[model samples]
Target: MTAMPMTDAPAPASGSRPLTRVLIANRGEIALRVIRACRDLGLASVAVYTAADARSAYVELADDAYRLEGTGPQETFLSIPALLAIAHRAGADAVHPGYGYLAESGEFAAAVTAAGLTWVGPSESAITALGDKTGARAVAEAVGAPIARGSAGAVDGVEEALRIAEEIGFPVAVKAVHGGGGRGFRTAADARELPTAFEAASREAAAAFGRGECLIEQQIVAPRHIETQCLADAHGTVRVLSTRDCSLQRRNQKVVEEAPAPGLTAEQEQVLAEASASILSHVGYVGAATCEFLLGADGRLSFMEANARIQVEHTVTEEVTGVDLVAWQLRIAAGERLPEAFPAPRGHAFQFRINAEDPAGGFFPSTGTITACREPAGPGVRMDSGVTEGFHVGTDFDPMLAKLVVTGEDREAALARSRRALDEYRLEGVATLLPLHRALVDAPAFAGSGHTVHTRWLEEDFMPGWTASLTPAEQNGAAAPAEDVEVVVEVDGHRLTVCVPAALAAPPAPERRRSRRISRRGTTVAQDISGLTAPMQGTIVAVDVSPGDRVSAGDRLAVIEAMKMEQPLKAPQDAVVKSVAVAAGAGVRSGDMLIEFED
Candidate 1:
């Protein structure tokens, strides 16, 4: 297919001017990422945080910081008025919406411009055109980009959805017109499942994005999720970076990303890169953008959607290409043109999203204070994080704790480095995806082969005990099967000894008649003192109260250090500290009691 040329006019000449201050309109790793980029460019940075994030590392690292009211996205991060006020107050010359929470919102982009601040992203028109999946598909088709054979517009209801599903063939995917990140999407194998899938998808889309309009598309089975990273400038210069394989996902959210996807033929790579550049330029694209494509089993590529803002996996591209995308965004927004030609990617790289989520517990979100976060450091290892050892991991925001990126000579080297980095990583206060990532990198399929969107699902169904077996030593006790005999044990490090139950010389057998009754007594007793147990594996940072100190409920007793965050252990009820088993600087496990209190 012949590609059309981009028609956007060149950006005004502002590259010569130095950027003085930048405001990060987002949080977490991405926000910290922008701050670092600004620092490298010799520009001041301002971080806007909610009450929950006031203690975040990003706030402390930035040149200036301010608090936004409310704890949630709607009440703070997504509030345009609040963001504008912050930018004005901070005297920020530019605003970078790291990604998500209005990153792709055209209204937000326009508002930033209206407030006389540079929006470090694509043109608002381009964002609007590509933000809506339906509109994006139309643009792609108009520009001769390959698209799935399905509805050309939004499906009105279940009846319309059924018709489109039939036309598109069985196993159609219903996606929210304005959705990303896997929410508001459902797949149906046949007509029997269409009604339920449509209803569920619409409801989810509405609840998540406040938009119910959905479009049905033929589900591409065994499709590899590949995306092209492109950087464009106001001068109409566009460069297509390497492609990334983000096929390792769960529920549509990417968990692992690698650049220069393995197993791609020279021709296939050329086709994708050329098509991506064609589409972006044809739309007069500017700033940083990612054109996502679903590479089919047959080697044909189809348009999925175009992300108008910086992506989470952009780090993988940066590591391979040696390009600072955030810096380029700021320059482009300041009216800089891309170099005569973009630099070619040099090596293989990968990025793992380190999240505080329990893979064994169905990937449930885990929250707590980080006590001792030890990030990996070495050649090709880069840690982009918004947290330190004393920060709190709150439930009010996304569970992502940081991103671990590694670069190497080739895919195999990158894989090896990733494994080594994962080994070096340590988080104490809460469960994280570390175990799952370790299992994934070690799996035969992952180690020996590239990936597709369905890869994680296949592994999840087949590798039942993979992640369950690698539970952190802190979570190991929680995963232990019920025990009987009511034995009190003294545990130090990995060693354990039975200290209680002097009447019993050995642990009771599982099938013994008295085992069941003894189990109840043991459970009750354990529960009573469980509160005294260390909430996670960490070193004691402080002991606010000592033995014999009378304390009311919620009084701070001690602080634990894990994953670079501080967790304060508080008294559960009015009581006197009878004995302090641990002092400041002592290390503890999840079930180790640090203090004893008198009732």
Candidate 2:
């Protein structure tokens, strides 16, 4: 692929304009990351937060902190005016949007630039051109990068989506034109699934990015998710720093990632590097960006999309390449030039996303106060965390609590180190993926240098019979009666616990047996046999069942939107809905009744 002609872009900052202060328009670990970078450069950092994050670590670490008065994301971090106002009040000379929220919004970038503050990312024009999915595809096509067949641009509606899906063949992906981090991405195996997928993708895109427009593409079957970390300067230089494999995923979200994607041939690496550089240079993109691709088992590469801002897995690339991508984003925004070449990647690195989710329960988002936390540390291990003991994890935003990255001289060594790090890590009062991470590091499909895993490996293969074993804390994490006797046991590597009457354990028959049952099922519907209740906190986006409606097992009864993803609540068995307890758009708690069934 050859670099195409450049588009109109903002003029480069005049001769290395220095930045004195930077406003971080985000929350959590990323905000703390940018604050640390600002400190490294001797630049004052300003932090903004909602009521939920008022006492977050990032706020206290920043040089100045302000509050954005509101509860939800729209009223807080996603509000451009609110962020700009904070920047103005803090006398911030630059704005850094650390992933998610308005990070990929061209409007936000333009607004910051219009306010005379440097935008620490690609130029607004670059973002406008490439941030949009359809525009990105067009750019890729112009540069002759390999791309999957799909619609030219956003489809008109579900009908149009169906038509496009058919023309491109079934098993199409409906993707949001804006945003990243898998917020608005869905796959439909056939026509029966396309409508729901389209609607869900659009709704999520609109809510997450303030844009509902979506484009359809032919789904790549069982491909490794590969991406290249790229850096660009205003002086017409683009560097493809490293390749990363985010093949281990669930719910279309990456769970594990590594740098210099394993098992890539020399030719594949060359193609990825060239195509990424060409695409960014063609759009006059500046600062840090990532170009993603799908590598088929047959050794073919297909362009996926370009992320305009830094990504969650940049840590893996940094570990292997020894580069601080966030600091480079700041330097590039301040008119610094990139070196002609970056050092070749070394060794191996892996990043495990420590999400506040219950792996045993279909990765459903979990929230609670962090009653205890023990982060890992040692040679070749780094923990980028956002929460602390006493910090409350909520469903109002992404459930990721932190990133655990480990590196070593090689892939095998890295995997071994990851196992140790995961064992050292611990948390309480909230369900997490820690046990899953511990298991994944040693799984046959993920371990060793010759491992074969794809984007759907976790969902399709690894999780089929996999179950998460609870720690002693997790077993006792929930409140229980003082009279309840808890007994824990392990059978065939599966942990099982029971709290029952004292007589039951005495080898004698009791007049009555009272016990609490535990089930490892998807946490969208209640476990009760008579009715369905919400298993987590969220808002009901749709109600597919009504009173007297007949439903069979596995039929979607409703959908709950939480943590920017939609989880479908399904009927547990054949039943007629006797009554509906919750309406669409209603907020619900863990035990709130959603539907009732007659005996």
Candidate 3:
């Protein structure tokens, strides 16, 4: 195991209100994950769900369930008051903010503690300090860890960003001060792209993290993304489980992860462990956390930021280290001491995220009920999912369907296991990343020297041109009808549920909401220059041009916020704006016209 220093904080007394119940303030896979952890620890789990997730698989698995009245996150998961109320009603002794939504919210942590509920995470002060990208950079510097050369703190405006961009040179990354999973990251190769990148990054940051603060850093060309997994108890004992290589990514979001990252020297490993331990110790962080760093081609390691909560890829670490990270979080929160040190790595482990996206169609999100489902089984293959055969994937939450983790004695064996697992995984109704993962494991580049591939290799080099052939209908822009949906409606604080048979099917996809176009076979219709239409469903956050405005082919005519990313709608050709069809804050669908241009 990775090494660190010892501490003397006392454990909570055995008689001090032992935690027997936990309320999960999240949804989907992570909620199920926490419930399983609670079960393993002989504790009961309560779940909270929004109207959109009333039938989620995880909610059904929890010991008890409570409904929060709303659809989107703001009215459900992100609502601190609503979550606390559920805890009170459920008689929950603690709350587990599983991974997204409020997992890293310092305010939520403070609120949970103030409500006299145990929060299964680090202290609020630590969350506030390390959760802020800019603040974490400062902490890294103070702890003698190397950090990238860039802005000293959060950038305020375009002018300030321009100055920082000049100082950091070209090919700079505009990153949110409180973002992860690449949700709030953008790169600008030159000054021309800086303004758009900065604004989009800031907006994405605000939408995802509720903070628009950003910082500019020089993009480390072709660097490897590595992180150290840490488990610390209230007693100040912090143990590093293993290093994970999250180099396989798309748009900064990790796609594939493995433990004991390939191609690192002993010295590199030592430095990573030391750097992670130093930061976690300095902040007095407790529970589960991970310290991220970027390893450059020259072998220099620069601290990126710290995830103050257990990360999505923690399973890879668990696979290699034989440690239960979520259980550790619960134990540490209950003031129990961890083992003095964790065991050494036993085998190589790989994790592939199964996202509900159509890789053949620009990775667009696909939502529908899973008509059929099957998963890989047997030794060394594990699936952690909150989805099943009848599960309905929706747009109100993250697109991930589940995670597949596999282990073997070595990298080659692990790759073989992963290939078998991918082959065994079968599902119908919605598209997934399964085929992409299948191709990667079989590719010679990924099997041999490909082990060291960088984050951009997949999307930029391979995936764009890869064959995701499924059916002529799917490729030629014909989508199967959405299955009939049955919903449970609440009336007078009572439950009323309605079920519709799949054969009945729902109405033809709304006239203005064509779900997809531009498939792998390249058969989708071309856009009409006389009118501008939304490319996908999202909220129109801005209209950049007005009627009668002249614009070039490349001008950004508008911006849409969807899935927490800011997508720019650009002009297809030089044209004069005839009319603005949609207003700011309007809800739009893929085929909804947003602007009209002069013929």
Candidate 4:
């Protein structure tokens, strides 16, 4: 659709600004998500995009497009002033920050409030108190919700963290009080590792969220991750949608999420619902929010943290509860109350994140132009995707390309349907986790009522050994190396010989980089790293060492930011820094050099 010119209709002269026109301050599926919600409400929509996202599908779907000049999220989506200006330029009276980027930023919310634009999220005070884990734990405790035994609040320093860890016992998790998406979290098994992990987690939190405060929590061994979906209004009414199981994860990032969590008894479910309602009601929370909890296989639950915005896995809850959450968010922001009755969860729902990652290659990003694509459909299947053929997958944002949500009368039926749906999903040019997901749904461990899954279960039990048996061709789409020579000979009576062109073989080079893997022959395989190459594609955020500085085995060399995760490049062994190859803010590709070290 072509862009529509801005209309001059003024906002309603009322208590809260009515969402006549909404300016979307995010990109990808979520931008489309908010736009669709606006369509459902008969509200005009304005969409914004950075230069990189100019060709995005969501950009064209909006009634109006406000083009912003930038490439990365920092200069585009996360720029609050730019978003506010776009809201004004598009004559938008409301702004919706779809989950990532600046979704949980209290400053952004306050700024929107100051600008008199309807911010479709919780109040600034609620976000400030609940967005941080330490603050949320306190609020949960205040409402009589069960939280893990740990620190009173944000710990001051290593000294304070050490004290808390001592009281909580060993194997405690030091987390970024201001962090989300598991970015600035670390686990220390004992006192010897406490200070280092604490310092690292703090630095990462400061680098990512601009806040250095941290909290200590006792690690729940082999615990399932569960979350409750909730909605509150300008009034005091709070509705508990449903609960989800989000324990299938890698590096603390959830990969698969399901609603009406598997093993909880009726009593447990009631307890969860009551506790969530009490917490939100006490905090005076407004709009869509989620309360995360940690549960053991024995059915014990502990509230972990709270997200003040719609979560990535909200679709599964919607599929089960039959609630249009985003629409309710807009309605709630426009001063509407929840419906008198919510449909009790009718069926089981599952959402699998279709990420641009190579599962066999340690789940590293596999970004490029998507050559072809097809999403599953035809009954109980939903694909909330943002890309089509020729879409460029970049590292500037999150790697998830889409989500595949399927529902059935029960968990068994959902699993059966999910298997067929995974087989139907076909995409090329960019590697995906389809194969891994297919295996998971087909595995017996996930049969009947589904199985218990913990946070580390995927990485620990599934990923490592699963990939070893597959040939390189089966893992990556790469075909086997061509044979050295091809010969054609007639064996019947006539002798005829033809020699075809052939590839070469050589002695393998020594392993020196993160990408190198030992061949089956025990030969050291080189992975094309010239000198101190980058492990992944991202912009350099910091360069710590000089050309001639001596460094230890664990000294930090530099920091690279990709997909909101900060990857620190540390020296593998003691050496002198021969030369610094890249400067801060320079974008580097996988296997591109960042620093060279002299042995």
Per-residue lDDT of 385-459 in model 4, one digit per residue for the tens? 989988988888888999999999988888889988987887777767776787677555555445856887887
Give the C-alpha miss distance for residue 251 in model 1, angstroms.
Answer: 0.3
lDDT of 1: 0.75
RMSD of each: 13.2, 7.4, 9.1, 6.8
What is the lDDT, from 0 to 100, of the residue 566 in candidate 3?
A: 56
Task: Please identify model 4 stretches exceeding 4 Å from their true place.
Answer: 1-14, 447-450, 468-526, 540-559, 568-590, 595-599
Of 2 and 3, the candidate ahead on TM-score is 2
Please give each candidate's TM-score. Answer: 0.77, 0.90, 0.86, 0.84
Off by over 4 Å in 3: 1-17, 470-518, 521-532, 544-557, 568-578, 597-599
- How many steric overlaps does candidate 2 have? 0
Candidate with maximal TM-score: 2
- Write down the worst ten-residue block by lDDT for model 4: 518-527
Cα misplacement distance, residue 204 of candidate 1 (Å): 2.8
lDDT of 3 by residue, 133-179 (tens): 98899889888998889999899898999988998798898999896
Q: Give the Cα-based TM-score of candidate 1 against the true structure.
A: 0.77
Q: Compose the digit string of candidate 1's lDDT tens values, residues 1-599.
A: 12111123244565323456889999888888898887776778899988777778788889899999874567788889999999999888788999874888889989988988888888788887888799889888888888898898889999999987887798888888885766667788899988867876776666556687899999988678889999887767788878888888765667888897778899988888777877788778788999888888898889989888899889999888888898888777767668876667778998889888655544545677787778999999999987878778765566788999999998788889988998888777766777678767766565665443343453354335443433334122344333324343555655443322324636442221112222111011122432466755666766777777888766677766554334456666677878888887787876688888775
CA lDDT, every prediction? 0.75, 0.85, 0.81, 0.79
Worst 10 residues of 1 by lDDT: 516-525
TM-score result, candidate 4: 0.84
Better of 3 and 4 by lDDT: 3
